[model samples]
Target chain A: MFKVKVYVTLRESVLDPQGKAVTQSLNSLNYQEVTDVRIGKYMELMIEKSDRDLDEVVNEICTKLLANPVIEDYRYEVEECVAQ
Target chain B: MFKVKVYVTLRESVLDPQGKAVTQSLNSLNYQEVTDVRIGKYMELMIEKSDRDLDEVVNEICTKLLANPVIEDYRYEVEECVAQ
Candidate 1:
């Protein structure tokens, strides 16, 4: 099997309200060292063994569903998962 | 500055409806090779130059706000960011 780790984040130009809220919360907690925060999505895909080119499959999935290309950017890493 | 990347994942025992939905969507899109999907959160914190131990601060933030230890697991990577 393949373990695919995906990260989706808002584009630099987009404002992230959730990230702002978190930063404010941290500041209120006395963590004055925190300058900024950006919240995003992380996903793991347990892909069954397949002969197809993994890169192509993953790219399609991320572009089509995992990320909203207009406002978000995504990247992924794939690793072979040893069977038990 | 320091760039900290945090990944928060649901515990193995927890049910992930969002992941299930994504898996179903992939299956419908003919990506039959996908076996399972797990969704999580990714956050990036930009910390200003500070004298405090970063690991300790990150640990506290993750536990107190970034993740619910009862249902999720979180890990982070910290890197120094060169000033522009």
Candidate 2:
């Protein structure tokens, strides 16, 4: 089996309201040391061992469905996982 | 400066409807090799250099606001960030 960790973040050019709100909240909560915040998505996928090229499959899945190409950018890591 | 990356995921015992939906979609899309899916949140925080301990500050922020300790689990990575 394989464990895939995916991270999706908004494009730098876009404004993240949720992040802004969180930052404000942090500041109000006395965490004045925080300068900025950006929120994104983290996903994990477990894949049964197969002969398919894992990279190609994961890339296709990330682009086709996991991320929004227009506003978000994505990256992934794959690791071999022992069967339970 | 410090760059902190936080990952928040549902506890193993919790049901993730979004993950289930994504897994079903992937299967229908012929990515039958995928066995399971999980969805979570990723966040990036930029902190100004300060005398305070980054770990303590991050831990407090995460537990108090970033994650729900009851149903979610969180982990973080901290890296020194160069000024732009």
Candidate 3:
């Protein structure tokens, strides 16, 4: 099997209101050192061995369902795993 | 300055209904090779130089705001960066 770790983040040009809210909350709580915050999504997927290429499958999944291509960017790491 | 990347994930024992829903969605979309899915949060924080230890500040922030200690686990990577 293969384990894939995916990270989907907002593009730098986009505004991240949720992240801004969190940063403001932290500052209110006295964590004044924090200058900025960007929030994103992380996902782990377990895929059974198959004839299809792993990279192709993962990329397709990310583009089709895991991330919004217009405003978000995604990257992933794939590793072989022994199924449990 | 410092750039901190934090990943917050559900504990292994916790039920991830969102992940399950995504997995089922993928299956219905014909991505049957996927066996499991888990979803989590990824965040990036830009912190100004401080007298306080970086590790201590990050740990405190994660515990107090970034993660739910009861059901989530968080890990972070910190690196120095030239402020822009």
Q: Give all candidates' CA lDDT scores.
A: 0.96, 0.95, 0.96
The regions of model 3 sitting more than 4 angstroms off are none
Question: How does model 3 score on DockQ?
Answer: 0.93
Candidate 1 residue spans exceeding 4 A from truth? none
- What is the C-alpha lDDT profile of model 1 across B1-84, one tens digit per residue? 999999999999999999999999999999999989999999999998778899999999999999999999999999999999
Evaluate residue B31 in candidate 2 and report its C-alpha lDDT on the 0 to 100 scale.
Answer: 94
> Of models 1 and 2, which has the larger lDDT?
1
What is the TM-score of each candidate's chain B when compared with the real chain B?
A: 0.94, 0.94, 0.97
lDDT minimum window of 10 residues, candidate 2 chain B = B47-56
Best by TM-score: 3
Tens digits of lDDT, candidate 3, B1-84: 999999999999999999999999999999999989999999999999889988999999999999999999999999899756
Predicted structure 1: lDDT: 0.96
DockQ, per model, reads 0.90, 0.89, 0.93
Better of 1 and 3 by TM-score: 3
Which candidate would rank higher by lDDT, 2 or 3? 3
Task: Place model 2 in a CAPRI quality band.
Answer: high
- Tens-place lDDT digits, model 3, residues A1-84: 999999999999999999999999999989999989999999999999888988999999999999999999999998899756
Residue B84 C-alpha lDDT in model 2: 84
TM-score of the A chain in candidate 3? 0.97
Instruction: Report the CAPRI category for model 3.
Output: high
Model 1's DockQ score: 0.90
